[model samples]
Target chain A: MKKLLTLTAVGAMLAAPTFADTLRLGAATAQTGGLAPYDAPVMEGIHIAIDEINAAGGIGGTTKIELIEKDVRSDAAQTSIAVQELVDTGVSALILPCDADPSLAAIGIVSSAEIPAISTCASSPTLPMIGGDYMFANFPGDNVQATVSAAWAQEQGHDTAYIIYSPDSQYTTMPLYFAEVFEKMGGKVLGQDTHSIGQQDFSAIATRIAALPEQPDVIMTSSYEPDFPSMLKALRSAGVTSQMIGSDGIDSPTTFSLGDAGEGVVFTTAGYAEEGSPLEAFNKKYMDATGSESQTVFNAVGYDLIKVIEAAVLAADGSTDPKALRDAIANLENVQGATSAITYKGTDGMPVRQVSLIRVKDAGREFLGSPSPDAALIPAPRMQ
Target chain B: MDIFLQQTVNALALGGTYALLALGLAVVFSIMGLINFAHGELMTIAGYVLMYCGIAGLSFVIAVPLALLASVVAAVLMERIAFRPVRNGSGATMLVTSFAVAMILQVLFQNLISTRSQPVLLPAMLSDSVHIMGMVIGVNKLAAIIATVVMLVFLDWFMKHQKTGIAMRAAAEDFAVARLMGIRANTVIAGAFALSGLLAGVAAVLWVSQRASVDPLMGFMPVLKAFIAAILGGLGSLRGAVAGGFLLGFIEIYLSAFLPPEMQEFREPIGLGIVVLVLLFRPNGLIPSATLKAEKV
Candidate 1:
């Protein structure tokens, strides 16, 4: 009777669809709070891509991609809870928040369930290293981005640089990478200072920079909006006229919206919307879908994440099985995306994608060509 | 000498804002025995008003008054709608109620305005710096110091001379006796919230000047610091709140200026540790109130 019952259950399963008609992708990204500026755009890009893909032919030309999203509210504890809730719903893959600390919060659940997870735009290489094989960061590594900035600064003849870094999170520690590569390129680090996140007053930091006998040729930091604007205003107000170099954290309307205060600041990001490039096309779609022009590279980063998943599904020959998907994604090579051709194969889970150098010119982003730094100069990921 | 002068100005500017906020919290807590965590929301209310006024292209002259008024009105309504029903409950109940009010206000701000920080444009002169004796000082920082001093003076007169102010003070000293002495509990409590809201508004303007933007959670940090300042001084003692605010500001700025670069990240912990040491020495805070001392005895 038991054998017959098992055979009947197997027969019923075979009678159902041969493969899942829909693939559930769970996202626990910040819709509100501090991380919203980055995660919101990325989510919009993801939405646009999912809509375009499902409308065209769905992933692997059959299974529709279904997004099950929860706002983590930029809270780490909430990230874990949201991830667990999504996992309980049997999601095949997870899209975590855009910061390393919050994304790290969801790793245990996703890794234990063998479900693959990807951060929207966390540049920290530590995500993959710490989250193990099943976790991936869908953006360029911090070391890679920082190296690009340092190389660009060298090319611009910036011989001495001062750094203001926040030791608060892995995301804010990009200055260390920049400092390492800058020194490797024979540039002198004039000074390095620290600011806590949510620190509104930058007068002390600015005063220190201004008090230097000979001002450095450039200043670098990884501060984001709210803090970034105040920092720039304080530095400029304090008469520190050095060229400012920032990481992708400053890629927000708030930065450009500073008008004259933000003028001539350069930052490194995941992609440049080069004319006629895939990123440019995505920007067009984004404007139509959201009725606002894409302001940051994060929109492209979000578009790439969906493209990556679709490519993996097709590469796995239309299997939605978690392990099969993870293996296929780990082996994906040169999958052309909105940002650049992403290759996860043989690179652990951190993609060596193109890094766009952007200038805050005339209150808007000016795309400088994606320049690949000398690989040897790129610093190793800081484990801490 | 130049660096000393500059940081002193910075410390004063920061302390002034914290003092106003701490005084605001202390005002309500002294009268009601309820730590109004939602006092931050009053500041947030003022900030959002500034944002809206900026959007409407209103000049700062008009915007400032409108923003202050908005905060005062919001505070009155907040008490009427939320606190009145729970007024007769335990202190813990009112404390939880204030937290709920804060959370609800934050959610409303997120949904109604934006989850993102909205830029609040002030007069461009606010960003300008003045040079005096080889030292540069921000015009906004000076404004904050002046504003705080002016408010403090006015508050001093109001508390000492006004009839309603005396009533509120008497109520804070002993609510039951003040009620028997003909001070209406409702009127005095409402007056306290209004005064608290006004103080929060002034602090918010100083804060908003520095950031030039406002988000739903913008008030969280300032209020948290102010709460600490209030406790460090003595929760119900107005003078203690002011002293605590200045002390916190001085400690923070001096540490930032003097601490080695490698130890800069430890500034917060060290600041709190210093506060703990001070508290250990003076368990009743720097200036415990007579009523509080009597209750302790």
Candidate 2:
């Protein structure tokens, strides 16, 4: 009887499936180009997270994560080629570029290969909707970000709002969503205008705003960097003093470079750099590694992506199969991330994340608060 | 009436910058029959100089001249190093070579300086607005208009009075005849590039003043507009280039001011349509050069 029992246990052990020693993650990102400003920091954050995980004996205490990175050179065609090469190498998952249109190139390749991919910080909710189920965005969707900005604007006793947006990209059209949520929340939309992405002259737009019957109580735009600062200067120079509300696109050093012009202006970001918080710790780490303080909010975003993926790997019980990993990621909830608690549960592909409101003052960013925008008030993702 | 006047100031300010850039392109094209697309890089070079000047804590007065000089030097060097070798080549070769030079300079800017926009803090007074007859005008706008007018007047005198400038004009009218008349081709071409660079430098300062920042691609849009303006004005005619620049600016500003808010996004397309209509009727542009010639195929 003892000999028979020993033989039965050995047979069961032989039947069990064993996980691979290392899970391969393919990262096809822009290392040099326009997207490099955002992608480089995210890549650094990912490297930090990978180091942390590997030091802790990897995800699920055994299955190590191996990152296979390729530079897409910020080109859509290069993105497709890079993704195909990575997929051919049998990567379990993929990390894509920071913009929706560019990431779509990789998404098409990943989806057919049954691999899951996530954008580093693309806020466009329409990204996943167009890229199919295998694609996910690890950042807050544009709808959620706009909702937060509008809600905050309403709470500040502002009633009249004007919107200026660029029709250039999904990210720049954030003001469209802001206008939708602002009006829905009982705030009146005075008007909305469009500017091309690279437009340097905003004097015409400013003059039109100045000619309005009554200046708007607030002006909202989703423009970034050079454009945002230029617009602000033009508006201020034209004597349009209505408060300015901006989305995450304005979370840049150039915005604060406006000096007094940038004062009291509010914008949304992924997380606040609160003292003693995990975000603060991560910033310290980032500074130590890169010899500069975090300039944009994407570093934390990159960190959160890896943590979410680690959670998914844990949930999959150490299985590195693409389908198993995808299923686990879709169901992940309350995963502790560097910036906030991340949840991908009960949504198409956008994770429910917190939005941080920051105000520019004294030539620096002041953390206002991280507010959870009301879910019911969030507008549906607009198809691009 | 007040709104119209206000928009006019806005138009002149923008138009002046465009005219400066357009005139820069026209100068080189007239002399060499080559549209130096790398003219934009000259503007970018000036921007970087201003940025570095800011970093060095130089005042606007000192920085502005230094920036202009840097642009002049960069333009001369660019022609000497890149354009001179291709000067004797086909028109297509020169055009392609200019594009290659522009690309190389852009890449160097991205790699050596930064792909991100770098801030250049100008005097706060530049952004201040003054009320005049119920119309608010930016100090920078006033400065732009004044500077453009002064530069234009100076260029007119130089072209007519200065020996080197007259030689440049002679070369523009007919390079082979000017060469036969003992006007050095190399000196005249280099002089044209230097003048173009000076105009771009002036425009760059105003451009940076309005935005208070610089980037690798900062000159791309303005240069493109300048190219369109040059085409709208007779490509080889300096005066025509100026007229085209102002016209383009006025059309764009007026369109924005009068167009319904809902149709604001169509401003560029509509503006371009007007340019096309003008070109359809007057193919040589608003002020076609008297020297414009056709080669027998």
Model 1 residue runs over 4 Å out of place are: A1-19, B294-297
* Docking class for candidate 1: medium
What C-alpha lDDT values do all the predictions have? 0.87, 0.88
Whole-structure CA lDDT of model 2: 0.88
DockQ of 2: 0.54
Fnat score for model 1: 0.40
In lDDT terms, which candidate is top?
A: 2
Residue range with the least summed lDDT across 10 consecutive positions in model 2 chain A: A9-18
How many steric clashes does model 2 contain? 0
Quote the positional error of residue A87 for candidate 2 in Å: 2.2
Residue-wise lDDT of candidate 2 within A323-356, one digit each (tens)? 8899999999999888989998999999998899
Write the residue-wise lDDT of candidate 1 on B143-184 in tens digits: 989999998998899899998899988998999999999889
Q: Each predicted complex: what DockQ?
A: 0.55, 0.54
Instruction: Please give the fraction of native interface contacts (Cα pairs under 8 Å between A and B) kept by each candidate.
Output: 0.40, 0.60
Runs in model 2 deviating more than 4 A are A1-18, A54-65, B294-297
